[model samples]
Target: MLEDFERGRVSAFFRRVADSIPVSDRPASLVITHLLAERPKFLEGVARLSDVAAVLPKPRSIDEGALRQVKAAMQVDELNRDRFADPEQATAYVESRAAGRSLGLLDVGGYFAPALEHLHTHFSGRILGVVEDTENGHQRYEELDKLHVPVFSVARSPLKDPEDYLVGQSVVFSTEALVRSRDDILNGRPACVIGYGKIGRSVAAMLHAKHVGVTVYDTDHVRRVQAMSQGFRTAATLSEALAGAGFVVCATGNFALREDDFARVANGAYIASVTSSDDELELSALNSMYARTPTEPHVVRYSRTGHYFYILADGNAVNFIHGASVGPFILLVQAEILAALALLASGQYGPGMWEVPAEVRQSIAATWLTYFHGVS
Candidate 1:
């Protein structure tokens, strides 16, 4: 049921990365966690690999049809995060599947990073390294006091630049679609983007392109300077950014908007997130402080002090509500992730954070350019 273009790209990626490693050094078993809704073809490709022990579906977003298709094609176990009441239970479930195996992890959004200490404590040297897919996850690994295994990140890789740009386009596309459905337009609205990372930069640029008065706020002074240099307005503080913003997009992939910051949002404004709710906004605090009303599907109104604001997708990533499809280009990042796992399986790296090797990045980029754009 997959498209030929997607299937071909994924196969070519696997073959290219597989050719670089001796068969003996490849991972014997793996546990992967990812957003099942975004790229089913890639997920299915990975699941069909020889040694996938289990698949953990990120509870936030999933496509049942894709999940079923992948399950029918393989005999591997499926673990749903929503099934567990606690992280420990999930970790225990993973441990159960990993019994008597040397396990590798392909993680997205740092789902398994917190459990690394526990996994390392129990599995010890039997655990291979982790391949993280997002900058949010990479930050989680960086915050750890000790890393039990090497973490190869494609988050900041040059290869991911295309995906990040597309992600920004998707965010704006979804936001405008939602707004248009309500008979509103983003043009001429005062917009604030609360992050200056790669995705944030793209979002700001897209908003500017749409004629929205976009102002950027970044915790990093360097990024703020960059934003100003790029001709977008800069806000030194969160309150200043939200002062009169009619549209707010949190792309920080961290807790960028907290309860205290809510009061500053302009009344009737639409607030959306680019990452998970927990990473971009303090949902728990907002739920407790404001009176929440379901304005419609994927839209909630939070009101207090006679002022109210709309939260898209109940504060979840707005783009996913509209399928968040960035198309076949995402395979580039997936290829880099596969290469990272291969490197980790080789036992050449020790416990610490590592970048996807230069050779791997170069190889993936070359393949992507040749296959997608007819570039040499």
Candidate 2:
């Protein structure tokens, strides 16, 4: 059977947010793109609240069984990334599916924003604003020259802080799981974290707690200084960070590592990512340059110049390979997204990026504490 939704903390959190909004203010239709994973049980609850037009499964991290369950239960049009080889094709498909519908979007990694942007011009129906869920997506929206609809971002919101920290924990957990499978241990190893953002900070901290030596490198000088202040060794450049570390984790939701950087990785070191492969590493270039051999389940060895390195999960987020399960704490971010959707449907915000209101974040935190910690 699929995960028990009735007993899910995330499902209950979604219900609580939904109940707080007036039915008249709920969006009439929605297009959602998200990771089809068991831990994130909020999708079904969101579907029940609106006319879900189309559902797109995230490419790398989708859980097939969970996708099947969602498809069977919701009966919404399901779009697969494989069918639309090019991203533009997926955008076109969503446009066709969105015809004549006043639609709101709940997106992960900003996959559908371009489609929504296109729909804004000639769409017959209203374009309710979007609620975006990741820093990567938030940056994608920011890069757009102009926004025709308001965007509510929960990525940098305080409500997401707990989830981000837990995500870091999961990244480390999965990395260790993969390492231990090879009969190796992480303790006393020198590690490099390629970003000093929210998730990267937590990953470095957790690794340090386990007696690992952590070196951090970020393009931002301020973040580098922050890492130094936190008592972790800070690298002056990417090459410096990769040169000696026994393990590497890419936490920046950007192309943090490239083909040239791979040459700097220590031989026999394991590298993993915390976000989508495309956003974290240049896999296509690496594959072309190195000879790849399957080393283990979710592990691959790439060799050149008589030195080699291992990539966990074929460069995808290691946590997903180990079941990207972050537990009930993720519900806080989900609640914020649902609440933002309701606000967007009300048409209170205009065309631009809007932070989730402080009061709304506070209210969500209060409710979370009440429900999970027995604190009002």
Candidate 3:
């Protein structure tokens, strides 16, 4: 019943955002993304309303159909996948790419803040704007709030309401995966969720709904209080959270978990990452501690302590792992991306980091409700 309601709400919300995009033809855009097959279709559709000069591919091991389509449309600045691992190279590449182009930047990870800063420093006038689609990226962009370039983000969209519904659906997908992995049903097992952000809160809610005992830990007192208000256990320290938890979900985007965390975890506790970044689980530190690499898909058994903990998607985004069925949620965000680019091209918005305008947001919600979901 909850899922049904969320689906209707998200679809309606997405349609309204789509409606807010000006009907006038949009200008050329440069899209930098972690290429996914579905993403290209949406990008291509949006381009018909606007011109796109290039689609820069960030290397993730996805099948190449969508990537080929993107290449067919325009030049693909093929950066080596290794560049993403090094901040210096990645930032440098972005600066080089953005040099002297007044094109709109449709950015995925939002790691291009340095490049944006560089463009500002060099006085190349201004690009159309920047659009970011990830929480980590949005947070990074907020740090540069003083920049003159017009910045917009779907990752920070009010429609998805990251703190509640959107994160709620994502956690539902992940919990389903976590439960299916075990032969025994997960009911009543203690689960520790780090970070009381949107993702963490949703994860805890779902786990608790499934009759799993949940403990939440966050550095912020307010978040901890929020967790407590929901009637879940609250941990004062990391050690306390991991002490007896049979399942641990690291939703914090920051590097919070480590060898010390593993040592503190219950011997057989499963540690999974809900955040997209590899550093969320600190796999490199874990690998250094282990003599051999994890051979199985998304499963890592430590060599030193012979401690076994399964990593969903090899510590990548557990929700987006193969067959998670969260594509609908991703599409909702994609719709906002298209609208964001259209807004940027319309020249209606000005320089400065800002939220997606409320009118645009409402338009998206109205479109989805009326046309897509038949909510009229």
Candidate 4:
């Protein structure tokens, strides 16, 4: 099934051949440009169409729900290099580029862009203009000369204002979506959280902050040690952690849990995944034994990222999937995404595989809501 998926999905050719392409005059657009709002790597089966042809990759933020569908459909793997291996160093690199410059702000839609613009405009410091649109072209701007926009790293956090905004509507949206999925684990009073990687660790921290038990679990002993040092349980194996756990959140990048793994899990052991790859956890195995759509129903989804089931958006990056509310932070995310797009196309970030920017994911969600869902 996995190989067929790889062949049927990932291996499909994307570029239109000369024989396949309809003849046209005036330099026909052989380039099939795709504006992706969610993580592009998840949609695995179209490169053949663009192979040997120009592929202009544009990023847009999309609905978290849609993001998951895209990932499952793509059958992606984590072969791409992580851009932020040393997050601090990556962030510092961005800062270095803008030593004494102001980050130029561009508001593409009525979401994060506006909030960020509002901050730059009304806040104490000098801020560049807030555009109603960026469709019209501009060679460059003055604000990017300043270092306001942190557009270089994996911006997964929320916007911070002078007064508490609850992360505001956006933060509320994220928390509620996450809570709904793992509510059972909370009810069970989990013994520990089995998180996969940095993202899983982040969620574990969030759960820990709420006094919920969190345990770092992955094939990586280093991650386990890191979690233990943080003063949490460290289990060498899945059984050790699941022995008394109320729930589990799998963030590991692999989805190879066979039927036996599920059997070992305690009955009604709640679980969720927040990784970029949706295939990491054996959702199919869990579905065979436990809840179904009839038994469980999806409540309102928060901005497409936060919904039930330890919410995961398009199996891309969890933070991006869960983040759909108005976060001024997304503004920087958009910029970094634009930077990434630039890198991919211009060969600055030579590519085999890569993820679309979180901001683009949100934007694409909104766009699809309009194009496919008939909403504006």
Candidate 5:
């Protein structure tokens, strides 16, 4: 059953990417992603697209056979290279590739920030644009007014159809692992979710659905009121949110949680982050304060007040760390990626951060309604 779902998802993604390309003009596109190592289906779909020139994988644990298959599918001698070992190597390779012509960059998690800067510094006019996938990346892109290139972000898309759906589904899966660890973990316990954005709202809703008391913190007064309107308690400050919560979830896409916040946490509470940005938590400070390394993969057990505090996924996105995130529903997000790449390839968007167009958003939503749910 699982294999069948994966196959269909990959096929649909490939078809969308292929359909979006123009026959006469297929520009060179460089894709840098950590998802390739974990989600090979994504790599397979994009690699076969007409515009793909190179792939830079930040490997966690790469499947050698899958990597070979992706490389073979590229069907080009242009910019073929081994996986990047670090940011410096990636920067050098991207600069080398951008030497002659303008290139398109498709990235997740802001991993290619340095390389993009390198292009801006030396090869000022060599970039067509960039397509970013994560909310954290969108926040970073917003800071660069003189970026010299366009950046269209799926995370910042005004159309909330995909983000709302994915965030809700992904958080449910992420919280499952925590529940399994202790059957009655959430019963009558408080879970504090920072941020009242789409992702944070979903996380809080899921927690509330599980009968866990939820407290939300967002700097925006309107967002705070919004949380209150949803029947979830609101916290005026980060410190207030950390008071006695048994579970803490950071989904703000900002570095809102700090070492000081952790100091106020309940002795045996659990902490997790769902945002792609590593900065959401003060992880380095957390490690140094403990004076110990994580005893298990993606989990750290720190002793506090004769009990222990638990940190999930090393403060990375919990859904991804636990298991296949959002299961096959990730295809909806991949469809948006295909649309963004298509827009870039067609030279339709101008400079600065752009929103994913309404047409693309509706098309993807229609695809999901038709194929995934048989809703027509």
Candidate 6:
């Protein structure tokens, strides 16, 4: 991109941040921003970081034992409890990503309202919503489950308010339950978990083991039972659980990181969206406010054979971001991106499995290089 800039192949970076236009297309100037982000795709096409990608071929999946060792090595407990506990960093991140439009989370699960709320307020007023995601998530909405589960999209009643029906959306990935449940058993600030489904349960158990305090508010009886059986106190009300949380972790399928929810939280609680969607993360308030505007353009690569994870916006999803994701998560995301990039670069970015450029693999590797910068 620098070369492109020097050769004038790309336009200068630009984007209208005013609230009037919510979803703006990526202008040519976006090329400059992507270059500045040095995202994998941008770096591959630019300075040719092919070796870095090659250096990181496909990674193998790991078992539970391997995961525990890595987590211990990373000192996740200390980080979660002391340094990175508050949503301030997460809010800052959202503010930068959202840039001025005020973030709006469509929370399918309202487990982490406190964290989400903090984001909206931190962004100077974004509107977020708590869209229930389970039959038990809301009293009035559980009946929607009877609607035919179309082979395609989830059933939607055009004539109904989600609060009036029970088809609560489900979120796929969330580490909140795990982290918060772990935090629940211990003594410190609480971490909120949004979704209480399968992954949510697993997260809760992980949290219990970690000895972290948790306060859950799910409509799912099974979830409540499971948590109670595990000795974790459950919250009967959303408002109660969100009273003074400092971190928000959402796993609900529908967007749980609503901007409006930010109102309930203090100025510091962190909001980490574990759901899968650029919609939740692509346009965050943090990004809009603090994201460097096409300043020193350079690719930011991150790869470490060991733990010390380089989370992408505090892991918007377990697959693309978390280090302890199921299987070789990073490799999976990298491989898919690589194959797609190869197709796109070759003008064959169609809907079939493809190969990733060696350079892209190498670019990911460079992200892991440890630099002391005179401190050492």
Model 6 TM-score, all chains together: 0.33
Q: Give the poorly placed runs of model 6, Cα more than 4 Å off.
A: 1-187, 277-315, 322-324, 328-376
User: Tens digits of per-residue lDDT for model 5 on 1-376?
Assistant: 2466757656775576457554344556777665333356675556444356567654442345656767667532222222232545665666566555557787776655545555655552356778788777777777754666778788766544445656655765666665556543566668888888888888888777777789999999999999999998998888888888887888877786776766777776777777543558876776545744465566667764455677777667777654434544566666677677767667766777786677777777776677667776
Please give the distance, in angstroms, between residue 278's alpha carbon in candidate 3 and its true position after superposition: 2.8
What lDDT does candidate 5 reach at residue 222?
Answer: 100
Residue pairs with backbone overlap in model 2:
none
Arrange candidates, best lDDT first: 2, 1, 5, 3, 4, 6
lDDT comparing candidate 4 with the true structure: 0.37
| Residue 249 local lDDT, model 4 | 60
C-alpha TM-score for every candidate: 0.92, 0.92, 0.81, 0.42, 0.83, 0.33
Q: Highest lDDT among the candidates is held by which one?
A: 2
Error of 1 at 146 (Å): 1.3
Worst 10 residues of 5 by lDDT: 76-85
Q: Give residue 201's lDDT in candidate 5 (0 to 100).
A: 84
Model 4: per-residue Cα lDDT over 1-376, one tens digit each = 1344433322222111111222221110111112233224222212321121122222323444544554454422121113223344423432333333222222222112213323444333322222212211111212223423322222222211211122223322344365465453354357444544444555666676667766656677788888888888788888777665655565544552444565555544444443323334555444444444322332222111122233233223333344433322223333233333232322223212234445644553444344334678
Candidate 6 lDDT, 154-242, residue by residue in tens: 11212122211111111113333333333321236575666665455555555555566766656667777776776767777556666
lDDT of 6: 0.34
lDDT of each: 0.78, 0.80, 0.66, 0.37, 0.67, 0.34
Off by over 4 Å in 4: 1-188, 285-293, 299-326, 347-376
**Model 3 TM:** 0.81
Model 3 stretches astray by more than 4 angstroms: 1-20, 23-26, 34-37, 57-65, 68-100, 123-125, 162-185, 292-296, 306-308, 327-329
How would you encode candidate 3's per-residue C-alpha lDDT over 188-282 as one tens digit per residue? 56889898887678788888777889899998899999999999899999999888888788877776687577667676566677655454876
251, model 2: CA deviation in Å? Answer: 0.7
RMSD of every candidate to native, in Å, equals: 2.5, 2.6, 4.9, 18.4, 4.3, 20.1
Superior by lDDT: candidate 5 or candidate 6? 5
Measured with C-alpha atoms, the lDDT of residue 42 in candidate 2 is: 75
Query: What TM-score does model 1 achieve against the real structure?
Result: 0.92
Cα displacement (Å) at residue 167, model 6: 24
| lDDT by residue for model 1 (313-345), tens | 878888887777777678788877777777777
